[model samples]
Target: MLKRLALSAALLAAVAGFARAEDVTDKLKTSAAEVLARPAADYVESRVEIKRGDATIVGTLTLPKGAEKPPVVLLLHGFTGSRDELPIEGTKEGVFSRTAHILAARGLASLRIDFTGSGESSGKWEDMTPQGEIVDALAAFDWLKTQTNIDPAKIHVLGWSLGGLVAAHVAAERPVVTATLWAPASNALYNFSHFLGSEAVEKAIASADPDAVIEIKLPWGATTKLKARFFQSLVTVDPVAAISHYSGPLLVIVGTKDTVVTPQPFAGESFLAYHDGPEGLMVLPTDHAFDAFTGPQTVDLMAAASLAFIEGK
Candidate 1:
């Protein structure tokens, strides 16, 4: 009986090891498919840094395939988000990924990165500000210019949510090839205040520690130990003013049914006002995240429209 038990244990261990190996192999195969099937656009994974006095802000850059000098795009994500948001399984296979890959198909290279302390990045979120994030995007652009495969004059910035604010600011400061903001904030103060008033936000605050406090009076009564500089920096940011100075093609997309940044009251004319360049506006019957990308839309209008604008069609 003892010998039989020992044999059974060994067999189970061998089977478990085989199963684990198979799982790993499957993941690798899936990843390879995603890359190998990446159309004509080539891609590379790299890193960059932005000097902030003695500190260096770091980020990742994913370049598309092309032999000649390619147009480079800097992709920015919203607060409490990272580049991972773009590559998420469903999200990636849906609109944003398709949009990016299609850009690659058109010879545009995109650099999607995490902010300091976000994702694989270093630095504390409390130590970063919206302005800091913009500076980082600028740094990524500078790095792109140094690459032999990229055209300095063909650089663009694509910001999503709060990232839009960052992209707008960068476009204003640099000679970007184009610009796009996905469900961007019309006004920092308004958006922040709006979020505070939401039921979800109230729950977050209620569940937070009582000792925490925010520097700025949030729209919601809740507060946190979030640094004072972060709040102060946001108070002065004006996305409309920032984008008003950009002359390249501009694309603004927002969901009509978005409750997070409510389109009708938050977007509408305000979006039309700042997008003075060649512009495109897409209002989908979706939410902030554009969950509709998962549906059987055949082709995502937002992605199609964005790709068309970015490719200058």
Candidate 2:
């Protein structure tokens, strides 16, 4: 975003020193790609669509080379974000794009979709709800399982922010291999109530008008209209409980300055307390979006950790 190419290169080179030992033994050693900034190669990408009722969920499916049936990772973006997301403001890469390429380098396939209404998908923003997102995520999972080339049993999910909440429910519902959440909003009501004031949402829902929509400004200074149902989902979805039902390993990544899902390590720590399984939590020193405003160190740390975890390393 703020031209961190120099910083990314420096940190990645230093990190490479730590991987020298593994490079000699590991089957697919880490690539030469500089910290989450890499072009799409060694993989094949295609446009894919999933049907949810009358709406079409558009996505980009990435299939990595080397593996005859590569394992897949479902990449879920944060709230109000698209499939590839905002590209870190200035760079040509966003979170999911880097994740897809990095995983591809390690012989892992990925599918990043525009969850209904937010990206290239067809739906109204006012009608978007957590429950609906769960439905869409499950539909994507179902579709992925039917694909001819990908390994059906090794599919994992990686979600960020509010999408983490949806990913939780999706993992709980599906027989996923592993579940990874980056800066997840497990306590939906608590997190939204702090950012999206509960008073205004309650008032809009109480209105007799069925078409009632209220305009609220996001923390990033953008105003958006929301229907009453979207607010109700804040109280309805329980991702913490959902995580408990998922039998696979869980990885929760967060930063110390994550104001959206505040209190840092504790918010992440709570996620493991509810679940009984192999779990990991990576806490960085940057903000919610993994050092979007700061340098790329935190993001690099997270990307490395996520890759290792998903690779079962």
Candidate 2 residue-wise lDDT, 191-232, digit = tens: 776566656655655767646687888878889987877776
| Tens-digit per-residue lDDT, 76-123, candidate 1 | 878767773533334435344455565676466777777776666667
Deviation of model 2 at 25, angstroms: 23
lDDT for each of the candidates?
0.62, 0.75
Give candidate 1's root-mean-square deviation (CA, Å).
Answer: 17.8
**C-alpha-based local distance difference test score of model 2:** 0.75
For model 2, what is the alpha-carbon lDDT of residue 39?
A: 46
TM-score of 1: 0.72
Model 1 clash count equals: 4
Summed backbone clashes in each candidate are: 4, 0
